[model samples]
Target: MLFVRKSYILPTAFLLSLIYLLFSSLPPAPEALDIDDREFSPPPKQNGGQIHWQKGREKHPIKSYIPLPTAAAPLPIPKIQHDFPSESWYRRRQRVNRQTAVKQAFEHAWKGYKKHAWLHDELSPLSGDNRETFAGWAATLVDSLDSLIIMGMTDEFEKALAALEQIDFTTTDATQINVFETTIRYLGGFMAANDLTDGKYPILLKKAVEVGEFLYSAFDTRNRMPQSRWQWTRTAEGLGIEPSRNTILAELGSLTLEFTRLSQLTNDSKYFDAIQRITDQMEAAQQKTKVPGLWPVMVNAEEMKFTDPRFTVGGMADSMYEYLPKEYMLLSAQVNQYKSMYDSAMDAIKDRLIFRGMTKDNQEVLFAGNAQAGMPSKEDLEHEAEHLKCFLGGMVGIGAKVFRRSAEELRIARGLTDGCIWAYDSMPTGIMPEIFHVSACDDMDDCKWDEKKWYRDVQRRLSKGTSAQNAQQEGKSLVKTHGLAPGMTDISDARYFLRPEAIESVFIMYRITGDKTLQDAAWRMFKNIEKITRTDYAHAAIYDVRDRHTPKLDYMESFWLAETLKYFYLIFSEPTLVSLDEYVL
Candidate 1:
């Protein structure tokens, strides 16, 4: 919990000595990704609407910026070629193979959920029982609807669509439902399917609108900031039930994309107005905050004020920041506010949150952490990164390319992407951990090599010979040698919740860069996940990624289908299927 001051610059001699001591027994650290070392200095006034970034080694490539919409020139709709074989023959075949594998994996989990936890929110993969979470809503089924459509599971999609009749978004049996979760999963899923199918499924639109109406009740507050949770059935007119006054940034900010899309589809401005007000309030309030582009994680609904001014791209506020640039892409480039906010936020992230740590071998490693206002005299600073935060890497990279931003910005995007991979690469299971400790090496007391067992295992495996004895040995050795257990720094908690952020970025990175290496890496990680997480009932979450024999956590989260499997399929699918250049997540 030690909080190091940014102003306290350590001498080179001290840092080198510490690094030498830490890596004396281990090999040199892996080559770190190149980070843009540009100085951040904002111009007094933006010239020609172009942002000025510090000149660096990377060259900024200029492309035609989509002009803001006007009455004379309407915003152009982004269109993608949905037909298969849009990519090269070899790449399309690779995608089809990967897509089939993902489909099988998803069906395995879905069959189990259907058999044991049908009509329930989630499945207990180990117990084969319903979890009854999320107000007894069929969360997994509803959440998986869009995924089924994406994967072309027609029969399964129809069956799931029919099953939706039993779901009632109106009544929650007095159980309070999360406004954010309900909106994102149910409303978002429904609208996504409706959009993907070109509104052929009226029922999906109907469900989304119904839930959107119930969700609208939470916006009854004076500030227009939606409450975190709501109990629609308990209230008359859905207005009497008092919603929570305090809410997190993600709940308030993440609504823009889905709600706005709903409004566009229905031609009802209320849905868009409900969320636009929140962003208007946010932009107005941004002037008073210490950091540009970043808002406090928590806010008071009643007062319409930020309560906790700590800035982070982590849980509770991650998606809020992500939606800024995306909203601009989805709606109109003329919505310059989205671009401004996103740009400022990126600056704050680079200036305050981003850092470089010297590994045991004096190698530089890039990592990002959260930043809080007002230095703490006695409190310890958090240097741990979460799996949820990994999505920022893809989001950043996607934004840079879509907006045709500076090359330095793209480097930041790639660097952050590499950082996410580093998290998985440094782990023992070759899977990303739920949470991990990241310490900056400053002195002998701070630098210590504790992953002795992992290093010894690596040495033993290396000495046995580089050549594999058989296929199993090859698979094991390949994963182990690359990242399976290339022990560097050990993580604190090693749970794998079947989260998709890492693979999600891999997919996005592959699409943006067209790098075959990314595709291969994703395949290796997919194999590792499939090998360890497969259970008789479903693909269960592991209690610890470090142990293949680790007990199952029992709970199968809805996102395992909604995001994880979806990303896996899309990563391997034809890149042009859902072109990153044309779409915003």
Candidate 2:
């Protein structure tokens, strides 16, 4: 519609020189455009190594991109930690405090609480005839706790954190012990938020150090991380690598946060170096996993060959990009390539695995490989709900934000907003299901986990009465001991949809741009939670999925849920620099 035909007359030599400079530095643009910016579903073979980005499904199928294996590099990924530069002495004090950091330290504590070793959201909080299993609780807790903390509601947060004090990270628990939380969430959030509350809050640089040391000890690096996702019980210590043992996705993503703090707090290049150690290893691991140049969910420590590709490690991608771009200033040209590759990976996520809006029914139609687009059909309801939530959650959290796809990013953001509203309004009760499988696993054991009784129960439930629809709501009449509501599946993990984690992304969207549309959207969420829902904290249970898991009084997530909700409420109603800066990550 708008074209300008004016051409500046420049010397041929000058024009030629300018063109050369541009091409030398810029990333290559692909010949084809990426699929839709939202609801992008990718098979495992879609993007091994192709960088042009605009190929439809066939252009770049998923395959691992294995870099040549070499001994671990001696240097850690370099850091650009020069301090805030223009920042002052008082601010620095707040950023590095010990005692004054107490306020924030507790926040770090809850981040610890949400880890795999501790009381998960649903099970730990309310166990009895009507309680839930460990996994159910953690999923819920991750949401509730993340939201509550962000909202500035610390009292309840402290209670949850205190609950975690009872568990020891060194011991094996029912669920996987999360090295990520032990390192990143607790350390990163505290250290970053230091003096962040208007210099009123002090930093707990020491606490962050303590957490890192503890994580290093727990991981021991040799044992690798826990075996939950792969379904290996800690008891089954020698389980094979075919299923994942260490969760590198969590491991590396958390490193970005923890290392950022270490670099700032110690002024020690070494602490920051340690972070680079993990990231560089991950980069190399990606290279190792490159079936042609694509990444899979999990890989072995030694071989570098992928254990599985179905899991794409979205969180890993998010954190890597979040820290790397700025970290580019820290590296020599050779190492700086890490930042370049990471940026491209981010572009790839935008290019695929994202969509404007997709119908849950159609997407969850079978397993989760890829969905065309449309709302869930009646037959698809129970499976698609949670899958959509996590998929959208990862995008909203940091992927969409870092990529800076303003319009396209916003569209992906709305997918969550609209999807949730649709789920709540359309579902007979507000309940969402545990998961929607996309790909098929030839091994039945692979499709289901070895350790999780919760998953097993659901598998049994689905198998009963001939099919998912006719299946009797297994475990009806809430088990207060385990907190199993009838219509709901496992409460702990299911609670991810509850609390504030569900809405924090919306708040972030609002915070970044301060768009009224986002705010309005957020307000709609707030009202639905506050007024339309049952209780202040419950966010009002909507469990019509199968049976009555509980009275729906159950709000058993870790704590992120409440923090997220509170964050949205404050930004939506108050809308100020003071409030916004306090929660800055």
- Candidate topping TM-score: 1
Q: CA lDDT of 353 in candidate 1? A: 70
lDDT of 2 by residue, 326-355 (tens): 343222122445555555554544433433
lDDT of 1 by residue, 1-585 (tens): 001111111123444345435533322111222335434333223346432222122112111111112222325433222233346777768767877998899999989988998889998988888886777768888888878888888998898888888886655554566777887788888877776676688998898887787677666443345657754433323223433556778877788877877765665656766676677778777757755557888876656677575777888888887788778766656467787888778777776676544344433444567777774511233455778887777777767765666777656666666666766665556677887645443331244443443343333433445443343445444445443433333355678999888888777777767677777878778888887888898888988777757777888899998888888888887665556544556
Q: How high is the lDDT of residue 403 in model 2? A: 33
TM-score of each predicted structure versus truth: 0.76, 0.50
lDDT of every model, 2 decimals: 0.65, 0.37
Tell me how far the alpha carbon of residue 192 in candidate 1 is from the true structure, in angstroms, after superposition.
Answer: 0.8
The worst-scoring run of ten residues by lDDT in candidate 1 lies at 1-10
**Superposition TM-score, candidate 1 onto the true structure:** 0.76
What's model 2's overall lDDT?
0.37
